[model samples]
Target: MPHPERNPFVFSDARFRKFIGSVAAIGAAALVLVGCSPSTDQGGTFADDGCTSVVVATSSEKVNLMEDLGAAFKDSAEHKGLEKCATVHAVNVASGKAAQYLSDSTTEWALGADTAPSVWSPASTVWTNRVASIAGDKVVAGAESFAKTPVVFGMPESMAKALGYPGKPISLKQIHDLIANPDGWGAAGKSMWGSFKIAKTNPNSSTTGMSMLLMQAYAASGKAQDLTVADVKAAEEFSRVFESGAIHYGDTTGKVLQNLADRTSGKGSSYVSAIALEETSLYNYNIGNPDSHTVQPGETLTPPDEKLVAVYPSEGSMWSDNPAVVLDAKWVTPEQKTASAAFVKFLHTKKAQELLPKYGFRPTDDSVDVSKYLNADVGVDPKQPAVTLPQPEPEVVSAAIDQWAAIRKPSAILQLIDISGSMDESIGDGRTRLDGAIEGSTATLGQIRPTDEIGVWAFTTGLSSNIDGTRVNGIGVVRPFGVLGGDKEGLQSDIEDLANSQRAGTPLYDSISSAYDYMKTHAEAGRINAIVVLSDGEDTDSATRLDTLIQKINADQKEGGNDKPVRIFAIAYSKAADVESLEKLARASGGQVFDATDPAKITETFQSVMNNF
Candidate 1:
């Protein structure tokens, strides 16, 4: 089907070239990237000058695409023809967070600016459905898909070939069978590769994860459409079995793909055998841009030695139909609404649709051929995923989400905090770095499941007494591992008390090593074992070397025959924190490092880290 002819505005080749040439001159002045802030300035810089500004809050993966489109729209004659010239501004916001912001008017909208979005375009329509369900249908209007990509299991080329991928129809049931087999890859005669570990994101926090969840339900029900609440319940066991094979859950697919690419460089394929992510992500990984960030001009990409192939589940899969929705909120003015509609319409034009394939997305315009980009060279088959699953009703989706919380893999986590003297230094608002971290950690406790095991430990040089009065060196257990259901209140209080215990030097190296040893020793078999380290600075005093700690972590995370996997998630809490060292520790353990260098973002950062479980 050809793109709908809704907007009469059309640009000829000469006019398009003229518009493109003028973009460099006006793009900078017109585009305003908004971040999280509490102030309410719905109209941006253009508002003061009698110009309409349409603020578009979009998912990170498509920020670059939206920014480019925004710039082009700004330069278009249609925009100039408006009674009041308009500027289209694009801001990067995660899909899940955007839903939260939209559902609650009291919530702060942007990070750097006070402006709320006039238009919201998340990676999938499911998010819009969620917002409409929570805030009513009036809140989300005119949701039109502009681009699409199906969710698929991305496996290493060798592994996919072993399963007869292109020749044999691989289904979710087949993958589940492999995971259920105690022999793992041994079932396929590849005894060298141990357990078949899979990587996925937390459904509550990711689009691909949410889509994967829905697909799993459909696969379990043996239907592609009209999935019911009873169907979700009946599939509970099937979903649980599939989830048990997960290596670990995260907030984004980028980290998993990046780690997989890094492992292929030298560390080998011991990290994860397969990952459930969008087809575009697999294409990006095959082209050596796992994170999927826009490649700049003059940038050279080095493809990984072990490229991944897209495995479209024979049971049927769901597509992330990137949709642009014009919100009908009180904050969105009439002029802004008109401008937003124009921009969304422009996104479907030939010029805009032509750029979609270049960015690893399938264009909504059927006339635009995607064969060149989605071909075997990038490890994706353009003709596949022959089956497309429909989105379930909002009620069914809500039920699935609730059911997922009960069946998802539980966690065994240790929170390691730095109470060094430097943490006492003020970071505006008369609050110290330790205060921010404490507040963030306390809030994170609410997000944890009751069945998960959690604990807290504070570290500073010469700390001899723990909360329980046990003697220790540099590290003191504020609370030992216990089920969150019974220990949450006490854990929150202990984490809060950490702010008053700041003293002495930072024994970062020794403390981390100690935490790793403890968690590894107590690692649970059916749960994700992890250590979350939040430190404000580098090691001021420690006998352990960085290389030595890295070697220890790598040895335990060996490619074959390792059962206990305790990942170490590091958080650089302030500008003074040693990001490089923390990154090395995280990478060594097949984990991720989060930067909370701006102390104020600690709460948000902490929540993101907890999503790994």
Candidate 2:
């Protein structure tokens, strides 16, 4: 476990410091990979270059641990009989994004800088299998695991105790029943806790989300493994029931954890009752922080006032075996392959493997003790993960994730887009900010369920007439709230027309209150009722105060009845936009905010936000 050998490149060394601070680019050719350079010496080797680089791409969650391991491997004098010097460089990327690069050859993942990875360490093997299916013979099967962790439900201590925590084991069925219960948490004698809300990540984009959906299917069939297409189809009712309580669906579990930790005490219901995330996330949350991006070395994390305890569902759960895979792509050189294998072997060493426990992960190396990390004080049970679910066929896993959006509850949404003067500003290419929003809106409309009801309202300082010359509150009603099944065309046209219209001043507060009240009154059951606000400016004309609006939303959300919950999804449209206030507004009703500050990302951001539905 001691330092292998003094790092050849010290912190004080210019080359080491420069390489460590390099940023990984997105949507462009990022030079973060290592490629072999031709030898000039008589032995056909470039030993003078110090070592050949074996660049690795690690899943976001494992970035911190992998960074430590990579540094150690690079500094090690000898690793598993490898004779040549080898440098290991680690970069963090989303598992899904990494899989996309491996599956497709034309993808310029990281050009010029580092190139394609010699090794890929995703959070789970699910991604490995997926990439293999797409790339055929290009992927090596059964990669070695360096760290082990499982998906778990993280709930507030008070909420877990209400469901019989220490004495009784909680089941997935029990959680689903709570979601289906008319009185929500009140059914468990906690009316003030309001309705049961679940914060989950997007299945199409997040590993935790994929595992959560699979677990629900397995739980529904009363089986822990061998989930078939039939089993997934049959679980529709269960999936629907469970997803009904979902208040937010983000791209990462870390964001959800941060939200829970933020509103833990007096505002218990501001975020969610529970989050379906990695056990590692729960461990991190209880230790006072949620995001590893902000974690500083030697900084002691302060525990939250209300700790989050991990509840291993009685049904079963999947382990995220952080697998280190050496891809068999054409870009991988023989020297790079050897170096990659050496690094993998080095990862199994006690020195590297022992770091897992400190990061809330179960070390894959059996020699490491796990008892201390899984104690009650850390919000986990040492012996409670009794069932380990099997990884279904890759096809089945894909089907289960693909079917989730279709089977989950429908959404009834009111899109309140800003048409204030700021929207008239150009976003380049002879297009205005409003033009970008219109493009995004049109694309998103195509993805919503046909049976769902949707409406569009354009707001500015003063009210205006509709395309039909009809006026309401001096504002324009582009498309009246109605079923998408019959009015898709009209709605699409109205959204386009909003691009051409312009007005003065941004009446954010009044527009939000009006939309919230309207949606609440016309809220549909068995559907996600929401008010989505797309604004590029702060409140300029409104009688309602921000605090008053927040109180109103919180009260409305907790009023408990047969009516569906109404959430506010705010999009801060530009850099100068007031995101802080928008985020507060969104979280007030247990909703989430999406950033569309960059004009180039407008379409993708809008489409991504719809993943919550």
Candidate of highest TM-score:
1
Question: How many clashing residue pairs, candidate 1?
Answer: 7
Q: lDDT by residue for model 1 over 1-613, one digit each (tens)? A: 1111121222234543443233223212222212112112222343353457778887656755665666566666556556666656556677887887788762445453446788898888889888887888878867989999999999987888878878998898888878878888888888788877888888887888888888888998999888999999999988887788887887779988887877735323477778999998887776556786544433445566666889999989899999998888777779888888888888888878886765579999899988755678677888989899988888888888898888888889999999999888887898988888888899878768888889888999978644334355898778877787866788888888776684999989989988898888889877889999999998989899999999999888874677569998999988989999999999889899998888888898998998888
lDDT of each: 0.78, 0.73
Please state every model's RMSD to the true fold in angstroms.
6.7, 8.6
For each candidate in turn, the TM-score is 0.89, 0.82
Tell me the spans in candidate 2 whose CA falls farther than 4 Å from its real position.
1-59, 77-92, 100-106, 110-119, 139-142, 186-194, 264-271, 291-302, 327-342, 424-431, 462-474, 486-490, 541-543, 557-563
lDDT of 2 by residue, 1-613 (tens): 2224333222222432232223111112222212112111101212234667777777555655565566667655445357676766556566766776677662345322344677888888888888878877457564878888889898888789999997899999999988888778888998766678887787876788999999999999999778998998899889888777876576677766665655635244545788898888777666555654434333344556676788999998888888897777777789989888878878877877765765678987777877655567768775767899988898888889878868766779999999999998788899989999999889977667888889889888677544334243535688888788867777888889886675788888878888887888888777778888899988888788899998998777556443477888888899978899998888667677887887767886787677677
